[model samples]
Target: MIVAFSVTPLGVGEEVGEYVADAVRVVRASGLANRTDAMFTTLEGEWDEVMDVVKRAVEAVEARSPRVSFILKADIRPGVTDGITSKVETVERHLAEG
Candidate 1:
């Protein structure tokens, strides 16, 4: 499964990069397959392991602000591995062929 999410700390003025970095740190340290883009951080693993990381990441942000905004999207296909890079590569291959 691949889970892509973003964590934003509310009421933290105009800049929340530091708080968002806290969440990304948690994701990076989890030893899971992951990627961080400008908009979201994505990780792939079993449901329990993935959710555990996400939970801790949200908590990291929660500690900094009274309110938090989280957005998540998941591609929960079983029996699939490395969908993180493979899925994107597949799309790129199609585009190159066109």
Candidate 2:
């Protein structure tokens, strides 16, 4: 499964990069396949493990801010691995071929 999530700390004013970084740090340390774009951090792993990472990431953000807003989108497909890169690569291939 691949979970793409965003944790935004509310009531922390406009600048929340530090809190966001804390969440990303937790994801990076989890030893899972992951990627961070401008909007969301995508985590790839078993369902339980991925959810645990997401929970820890939310906790990281919560430590700094009074409230947090969490958003997540997941792709859950059994018998799939490396979907993170392979999915994108597949799109890129089609684009290149066109």
Best candidate (score: TM-score): 2
RMSD versus native structure for model 1: 0.6
Query: Candidate 2's C-alpha lDDT?
Result: 0.97
> Residue 22 of candidate 1: its Cα lDDT?
97
Instruction: State the C-alpha lDDT per candidate.
Output: 0.97, 0.97
Question: Which 10-residue window of candidate 1 scores lowest in summed lDDT?
Answer: 11-20
Model 2 off-target regions past 4 Å?
none
Question: How well is each residue in 1-98 modelled by candidate 2, as lDDT tens digits?
Answer: 99999999999999988999999999999999999999999999999999999999999999989999999999999999999999999999999999
Indicate the TM-score of model 2.
0.99
Q: What range of 10 consecutive residues in model 2 has the weakest lDDT sum?
A: 11-20
